[model samples]
Target: MKLHLASAVSRLFSKILRLHYSFFSGKILSVRAICTDAENRIYLVRHSYTPGWHLPGGGVDNGVSVEEALAAELREEGNLQILGKPMLKYVYLNVEGSRREHIVLFTAQVSQPDGFSRNFEIIEGRFFSMAELPPDLDPACQRRIQEWVIGEFGAAAW
Candidate 1:
């Protein structure tokens, strides 16, 4: 009986710890590729869980720096070599109702790979001309991309 009680107490403590982490300590930081090719097309990936296209990136793992996470995500998702440093870092809330507090958007350039395979997390990836992009990208992603492009090209904002 003492052993069972001890086990129960341990389980209860574990549950409490998990709850605390989920509610207060959950953090997600990710690097997004703005991958622009020579023709100025932006690379976007389709997520397996969502309908709209998104930037190719994923959550940073614990103990990994942002740059390290970005490099790993780019290799895992796009199979392309990242060129140069990240263009931006962003912090935002998770729209899916998680306690995750941040997403770091790292703009990167990639040399188009001869071929690439999508992991189960991603369904497909392709480059889209700015004018030809789908209308339903994540609002935050679209805004960030637009701002970057405008800033890079010195385009007038209406």
Candidate 2:
């Protein structure tokens, strides 16, 4: 479908960007936002490239601050309008890949829902209750939700 094609293109674009940056920069920095609507439900997105549902986020472009990058990602991935300053939650050292990657997690409060449509980066997105999260959610994201929402964090790993 369109989502699959979009994801493939997204992955390809990401790979090219990574390749272009690898020759100049040694580390990669990204920002992620855990946004909540007026009803307190968490908004999650499924990337066209990734298999699992994840917090709405993307890589921080060069010369952009974490907050700036997060704001751009929130707008691009979910059409979310950040109402105020986002609280820094955690700094995760992502070791899932060969490159040195760091992700800055932020808790952001957003306005009421305006509905999300399928984009080239995000195929599907929706709000979910704490007790009924999707089974295919990224484990790291799941841990984040548990730690922030339920106040239970098992390990320090991400």
Candidate 3:
């Protein structure tokens, strides 16, 4: 019941954001990192203010590159110290209607041991096997992972 309520509220907030940004002049760009450990487990996070498990990432700040934004987000949200470079995975057009939003997905490997704690933005995080992912993961996140697995390459999503 709690998860359901949270999911409903999250969806409502996202709709509101889209509607609010519809009248804006600029587009919204965000980044997500499919972080993995040496054991090949995927890092997933649950936001304090949002429902569902999602890739650890956030918006790209002004004047900051997407890679930099993703790194900052990983550190802030997951205490993730990226070992090396992040590989580009997929770039998707997040939503239609009001907001012209785009999401750049990247796959990153972390070098350090996991020790993430609850923060203001993120309340929970854990690493899970690809086949054992939480059932409540975001659908878009699942699709992105699927695309990566199949080695599909093409134009950005619409």
Instruction: TM-score each candidate.
Output: 0.71, 0.85, 0.81
Model 1 lDDT per residue over 9-43, tens place: 65676567557757777464656667777677888
Model 3 Cα lDDT, one tens digit per residue, 10-101: 66776777677676648888899888999989899988666689888988878999999998999888788888899987677866433377
Clash counts for all predictions? 0, 0, 0
Model 2 spans with C-alpha error above 4 angstroms: 1-3, 19-24, 151-157
Q: Sorted on TM-score, highest at the top, how do the candidates line up?
A: 2, 3, 1
- How much lDDT does each candidate structure score? 0.68, 0.82, 0.80
The CA lDDT at 20 in model 3 is 73
**Position 157, candidate 1: lDDT:** 19
| Top-lDDT candidate index | 2
Q: Candidate 3 overall Cα lDDT vs. reference?
A: 0.80
Q: How does model 1 fare in lDDT?
A: 0.68
Please, what are the lDDT tens digits per residue for candidate 2 over residues 63-86? 889999999888888788888899
Cα shift from native, residue 124, model 2 (Å): 0.9
Of 1 and 3, which scores higher on TM-score?
3
Candidate 2 clashes between residue pairs 3 or more apart in a chain or in different chains: none
- Model with the higher TM-score, candidate 1 or 2: 2
